[model samples]
Target: MTFTTRFAPSPTGPLHLGHAYSALLAYDMARAANGVFHLRIDDIDQSRARPEWEAQIFDDLSWLGLSWPSPVLRQSDRVPRYRDALKTLWDQGLLYPCSCSRADIRAAASAPQEGAPLHGPDGLVYPGTCRPASPPSGPMPDAVMRLDMARALARLTHPLCFHETGAGPDGTTGEIHPLDMLQTVGDVVLARRDMGASYHLSVVIDDADQAITHVIRGRDLFDATQIHVLLQRLLNQPTPAYHHHRLIRDDTGKRLAKRDDARAIATYRAEGCTQADIRMKIGL
Candidate 1:
């Protein structure tokens, strides 16, 4: 298959230096490999997605001399598609509804007997508070949904693995360790009460649907790759090779966030910095 990849960003805020590095790196690699590079707007959280920011994404990428195919794939336009995937998992007894509030989870997870709440990609690994004792039945409720990781694992007919061109906490050639994931990644959210899908769920489906052959992101997300791999196996989609590059951090060594407006690409542009300057600033 031809090399293909994507840079998906939430339009919840301005694109910063880190965003530029990820996008430019993916676009550069795709160009070098004679592959297709896609730009996907991860605007699933409609409450925060704004038209101005969506337009700014286009403008910023263009200003950085990057381009992608027209009619960009916006997650906001694909709720039905996400729901269909959720429904399939639900029918297979691999997913269930979750009604645990943040406070409920914190209380249960912090109980003296449970030890400190274990943290995971989805944050504070779900205590399975709302998880039914058995696979849920009947129509999948239109509420928050989570993967039954243990059950999801049992459905896999073969060992799950993916090629890794990136450096993770482990070595290359990623492999899924079921027990490790069970304890750590535990029942990640698949659907949200308001957004209809969580980032993990939306990303897996989007990458597969777009036929992405390579997933390029920061090393920070290396731990989350297993979650995606498991989802790929469950959904019967191809797991792409991954390239997790180093993150762009501020002088203080903290990774750049959307709130870091000082490092915003737009701010740099206003300061009269050139694209070449950006490459140097990000150590590209």
Candidate 2:
């Protein structure tokens, strides 16, 4: 099969150095291999996503001399596809409604190191308080729907693994594997019974639809790959080769964030920073 890769970014915030690094790395890999590089806007979080941010994403990528094939895929326009997969998981008995509040989860997790804490890009790990007590016959909760991790794990055969294709710090190729989905990542959300879809669900569907054969992204999401792998298995989707690259950090050595607007690609452009400057800063 021809090599295919993608860079997916949410439109809730401006692209930053981190976004530039990921986009450039994927772009270079595709260019070097004479492969296809695609772009997708992860605009499923309708609450925070805005038109201006989406426009900025396109502007920023263009400024950096990157281009995706055809019209870009937008998640907001693909809710039906995500919903279909979600219903499939729910029908398979792999998903359950969650009713626990933040306070409730805190109280449950306070019992000490037992269940893995659930988290998202924002950072507070969710405690699976209702996972055990979840109702079988009621309507799904209004808050969230979580995957049944134990049930999902029971179906796996060999341990899961993914290979990193790009060159590394030690000049070695990297492969990650022997992943245990239950212990490390735990039961993650598939949707807010309130929201349209979760990141894991939407991403797998989109990647498959886009025919993405390789996933090139930051190392920070390496742990989350287990969750995506599990979803791929449950949904009977192909698991692509994954390249988790190094993250871009600040002077303090902390990973850059969307909230760090000072590093936003728009800011850099405003200050007349050249595409070459971004390329050099990210070591592309």
User: How well does each candidate superpose onto the true structure, as a TM-score?
Assistant: 0.97, 0.88
lDDT for 44 (candidate 1) = 95
Deviating ranges (above 4 Å) for candidate 2 = 112-127, 132-143, 166-180
Clash number by candidate, in order: 0, 1
TM-score of 1: 0.97
Point out the worst 10-residue segment of candidate 2 by lDDT: 171-180
lDDT of candidate 2 over 189-256, digit per residue (tens): 78865458888888889988998899999877766666777678778888888887888999999999
The all-Cα superposition gives candidate 1 an RMSD in Å to the true structure of: 1.1
Instruction: Tell me the tens digit of each residue's lDDT in model 1 across 1-284.
Output: 88899999888899999999999999999999999999999999999998888888999999999989877999999999999999989999999888889899999999998898999988999888888889989998989899998899888788877888978745555877888888998989989989998888889999998999999999889889899999888888888999998889899989999999999999999999999999999887
Q: Which is the leading candidate under TM-score? A: 1
| CA lDDT scores, all candidates in order | 0.90, 0.78
